[model samples]
Target: MRSFFRWLRPYGLVVYWVMLLGLMYLETVNNLPIPTDAEGAAFAQNFENDLSRNVFASLIEITCLYLILRPWSFTQSIGRVVGALVLVLLWTSGLFYVAFNADRISNVLGIHLLWLVVLNLGLVVILIWRVGRLLWRSLQQSRQR
Candidate 1:
């Protein structure tokens, strides 16, 4: 854990947190003092969708974080394979999102996204290491038989 943090950039994390706060503020803007009912309805729908998506994303991310902390917990648990694949997809999509929208993100958040890129990379590194460990263990077990 300490080593992971050492490998990840601390300043980028700080920037990310600050950007989250800024996003929170931006979320509230929703064009206050609406001029018409149509605008109000649009705002409500947009807000609800964004809020729901954020909640869902948070849940998935938290679950994946737990797996990252206990990679071996899923070893030999065939039922968990689907969940693992979902996480892999999530991270892959996240990376693509960042890569495709780097300029837009920077313009909105006014900060470099290197920290986020590094974050995804770190998670991927853990996944690779975990897979390697599992393969080695399985190979050793086969040799012992």
Candidate 2:
């Protein structure tokens, strides 16, 4: 178990957390401040139905995973691959439920929508930190080479 964690990069974990936080921010924005006017409500519903928040969230997850994981080489083990696939599927399912069934979820769970933009802005901070670390390490490796 320790070895498994050692194989993962710190930046990868950071990016994953950023992605999850970003998704939470998106959901919070989508649910908060129930639309009062007909035009605004219609726009919100249309945006949900036409854009498919699940698709956007999935794209962000995939892109972040690729960026964060591509630098490292992993052992081509079947178990690891299968596990990754299962995780991806499960994440997609959860995103779908959250995107489409948020009303029902909030009603049942009594969760309040607190859409603070600062939380979303935090992703930018994470990205900047990760990118700076990546560049510094790359430079160090090149100097050694």
Estimated TM-score for each candidate: 0.36, 0.30
- In the range 35-127, model 2's lDDT, one tens digit per residue, is 446545322332333234434544565565445335356433234334444555455455446646653333211111221122223334544
Q: RMSD, each candidate, Å?
A: 9.9, 11.6
> Model 2 — which ten-residue stretch has the worst lDDT?
107-116
The runs of at least 3 residues in candidate 1 whose Cα sits more than 4 Å from the true structure, single-residue gaps closed, are 1-112
Instruction: Estimate the overall C-alpha local distance difference test score of candidate 1.
Output: 0.48
lDDT of 2 at 114: 22
Measured with C-alpha atoms, the lDDT of residue 137 in candidate 2 is 81
Residue pairs clashing in model 1 are none
